[model samples]
Target: MKSRFTPLLAGLVLAVSSLTVQADEVQVAVAANFTAPMQKIAAEFEKDTGHKALLVFGATGKLYAQIKNGAPFQVFLAADDKTPAKLETEGDTVSGSRFTYAIGTLVLWSAKPGFVDDQGEVLKKGAFKHLAIANPKTAPYGAAAVATLTQLGLLDAIQPKLVTGENISQAYQFVVTENAELGFIALSQVMADGQMTGGSAWVVPSNLHDPIRQDAAILAKGRNQPAARALVEYLKGDKAAAIIKSYGYAL
Candidate 1:
């Protein structure tokens, strides 16, 4: 019996050893607008590759600053293309390591049903007491919102009622919690399965602002990391693209 069990034990030890050798923990900094889809992608990546993505979420600008200052993040998924290109120019990211991952969609949303119309005429009326927006300086989605307001000539009218959040996620939260009557937020935040879950929203037209061409980059710290390289590849795969599309992001 001992001899028969010895081979089984040896096989088990080799299997465990192989798993330990292949498993890698990749540190990632992600933009808040991409949170939900990324969470799904991370789970799928870990399951399929046996590599873990330890994620930290924030405004893209803040995350970029952190990466610049030697934060331990091995990868960055920015909400805009310019920041990653800037990092590459500054030698903070691997050369030829950046690529467009997804194009984001912005929405004018309200927690209450029927409060926001399809054409976004509520802004013209200025009936709401507070309007929540992410800080434009730190959030690409917020910058788009500002651009839309500027195009409509509503920026000056809405300035006083604005309630700014540090990031898009927090701006969405403010509307959900009734801290603000409505908000300009990423469509992904309030969407699931390609439909809006609960609330009234106007899917802002693409012409209203610059295209939010989100980009991903391998940081200098991850220049030679196998896991970091794998994660970037996985994000561009069909599975991840489908997941991102389900949340209303354009591929």
Candidate 2:
């Protein structure tokens, strides 16, 4: 009886040990524009892989600065592909670990219904007292907004009316709170399930600005972290792609 019980006990111990080894947590620095989708993806990732993602959100540039200063983040999801590539070139990321996770869309949005037209003629109309935009120096979407304005030859005209936010989230907040009549922001922020979540918006044309190719990478700090690698792989899977698309981003 003792011999038979010994083998069974050992098997149970081994199984528990395997479970413990498989479960892990990773710290991730994510772009503010990706908040909603990343939250959903993180939840799904934990349920499917038993790996937890601890997310910290901010503007891509600020996150990059933090990472440079040794923030201990294992994975980085940036608002533009350029930053991750720069990290790779700077030897701050794992080689061949960077990938484009989502293609973001910029939108001019207003919290009030019918306030913005589909053609985005409002910028030329210049009817609003305050037009909110993220800081172009730190946020990719804000740079895109500036580019679009430049292409439309309205940057000079709209310069004085501009209200700048530190990041895209804060820019959206300005519009939502009516501090600005409308703001340039990510399409994901105002979209859900293939429909506008609220108010009105003008989806900026791709030709108006450079493509917003958002990318992800495993940082040097996460080089040997299993959870970090798992999260990156998970982001490439079908489930994560669907979640990303549902938030108004492209593959």
Candidate 3:
């Protein structure tokens, strides 16, 4: 029995080797705030090219740390330019593959109607019991939320009511689940077909905070791969950019 089993081991290896030689999946590390859009983009990208996007969503900072520690992601679509720029400076990314894909918008949103009015001084009015924001320490969007509140002179007034999510996606979840009466989140979190749905929002005037510019870059892990380079180039094309803009992002 041992001799018979040993003879088939080489055949088994040949079968597995054939499968490995055929299919290659492109792994991408994406920001949590990009969940919906990336899912859509991945589908479109898969259809356009034979390659598939093995999408992983997490905070941009965490993804950076993971990549530094040898996570095998080929591309990174960060929530901000900082991480990508740092990767480039650290020689962890392809020099020319960096590009801004979209300008994100921060909004104060609520699942319930009239729960948020970004322009109506809702925070200063003190109408809500709780306001959720992402943990500014980890999320760029959350940091921007803090910056916006500070710029409006409402940071002090809103401090006590703040509830922090581990990331922007969770912050949106807090508002959606009614755990938070209102919260600051990425505008894309609530947008569909280039418009907002379900609740009223003020669209937080851009002047109140720094722009939310999302950038993508091909990591060193992908510098030598044609499929990864193709994906990065496709993201910059008119078709992909159009889809990005349709999801309430400004390209």
Best-performing candidate as measured by TM-score: 1
How would you encode candidate 1's per-residue C-alpha lDDT over 129-224 as one tens digit per residue? 999999999999999999999999999999999999999999999999989999999999999998889989999999999999999999999998
Q: Which structure is stronger by TM-score: 1 or 2?
A: 1
How high is the lDDT of residue 125 in model 2?
91
How far is 65's C-alpha from truth in model 3 (Å)?
Answer: 1.2
lDDT of 3 by residue, 1-251 (tens): 88889869989999888766644578899988888888888888778776688999988888999999999999999999988999999999999899998889888888888766657478778988889998887788998999999988889988999999988988998999999888999888898788787886767888887888899999999987767887888788887877788778888
The regions of model 3 sitting more than 4 angstroms off are: 1-23
Give model 3's TM-score versus the native structure. 0.89
Name the TM-score of candidate 2. Answer: 0.96
Model 1: how far is 116 from its true place, Å? 0.3
Weakest ten-residue segment in model 3 by summed lDDT: 18-27
Ranking of all candidate structures by their lDDT, best first:
2, 1, 3
**Model 2 Cα lDDT, one tens digit per residue, 86-169:** 999999999999999999999999999999999999888999999999999999999999999999999999999999999999
**Number of the top lDDT candidate:** 2
Candidate 2's displacement at residue 79, Å, is 0.6
Candidates in order have lDDT scores of 0.95, 0.96, 0.86
RMSD of 1: 1.1
